[model samples]
Target: MTLYPVEAGNFKLDGGAMFGVVPKSLWNRTNPADSNNMIDIAARCLLIEEGDKLILIDTGMGDKQSEKFFSYYYPWGDHSIDKSLKKYGFHRDEITDLFMTHLHFDHCGGSIQWNKDRTGYEPAFKNARFWSNEEHWLWATQPNEREKASFLKENIIPMEQSGKLHFLEREKDEVFSENKELGFGVLFVDGHTDKQMIPHIDYKGKKLVFMADLLPTAGHIPLPYVMGYDTRPLLTLPEKKKFLETAANDNYYLFLEHDAHNEIITLKHTEKGIRLDKTHTFNEIFN
Candidate 1:
């Protein structure tokens, strides 16, 4: 199996919101903020090449949203899904599975795109089966006022309409099938978003976890640093605490989704609690 870091694009988000309850004095060192208080974030997706299946972990925010809509969050960067795929001698059509960690715009937006005429949207990976949990599918479709903005209909409806949408499990307890050789185990996290799936992959004798919003960046290793964007911050603390303990015990490598500087981080148990041991890109660990 081969892994490629597919960087769809970069965007700006409020650093305070990204690191809830964490002070600017602490987070600014990890990621400095611009004049607008927005920090650069990468919509970094993972592409898996395993035999006949080319599975894409998440899609970056697509370029379908209106400029006025995009004004809220500035999306920048030259890297794109196509460019990342091409770098590995692959194409959109080559992807057999689109494994979404969740349906958040940044995670699943690239799953769908504008049609040729631009009148309606269509699945970006025409040949791939878009995977999302049934509970998350329901939650996102009938989103609460707090999360409505994040779960845009344009990015989701296309997958269901195209008949490419498939559910991993209905209940939050059950996740993807466990195939030891596949090296990818799904960890369902609800604090970030409903049933958000974080893939724990066994790579080169190392346990590598795709840290979605549960632990967005290395700076978020602190137990209390949950995101303000989370619907349930209380639930996030325990979730993060449990995950970190396990990661520290297992010596797992965490792959950051939004961290522009640090791609991978290892956590060490500390008196103050868990702390970051080291930081590096995915390639550094894999190569």
Candidate 2:
């Protein structure tokens, strides 16, 4: 299996919101903020090449949203899914599976796009089977008031409408399950959102985990630095602690999706608890 870092795009988010309750004085040291109090963020998706399967983990924020709508995020990069795919000598049509970690706009927005007529939405990757769990599908479709803004209908419904959506079966209340289709393990955690799947891939004798919203960046390494976007901040504390402890013990290479600068990271059990051991680029480790 081969892994490539597919940079979808880059943007800035409110530093305060990204690191909830954690004072600026502490967070700014790790994730320095700009004049407008915004911190750099990347929609860094991962592309996996195994046999004939080209599995894309997440699709960054698509370009379908209106300029006025995008202005709020302050986008700052030229990377696109198509362009990134071409860089590694592939195309969207060749993708067999589009496994979404969750249904947030920034994670799966690129899965659907405006049709040629520009009047309606259509599946962006015509040949890919879009993947999501039954629990998350229901939660995202019938979103609560707090998470309604994150779960956009335009980015989701079209996959089902196009008859290409499939759910990974999970036994009742199972937290971690093996996936036959993707040939990896998926850990379901509800602290960030309902049934958010974090893929754990066994590659090159290392456990590479896709850190979705569970740990947005290295700055959030501390236990209390959960994101304001998380629906259950209190739940996040213990969930993160358990994940980090395992990550440190197992020597997992955390594939960070939202951190603009740090692509991958490792943790060590220090006196202060789980702390960043080292940072690496995808090529540094894989090459």
Candidate 2 wrong stretches, greater than 4 Å: none
Off by over 4 Å in 1: 170-183
Residues 1-287, candidate 1, lDDT per residue (tens digit)? 88888898889999999988889998888778999999989888888888888989999888888899779888776889999899889999989999889999988998898999999999888899988878889999999999999999999988999987888753434644453433478888788888888898877788888887888777778888888999889988888888899999989988888887788899899899999998887777889
Give the C-alpha lDDT of model 2: 0.94
**Model 2 lDDT tens row, 60-129:** 8899999998999999979888899999999999999999999999999999999999999998889999
Estimate the TM-score of every prediction: 0.95, 0.98
What TM-score does candidate 1 reach? 0.95
lDDT of each: 0.86, 0.94
Q: What are the clashing pairs of model 2?
A: none
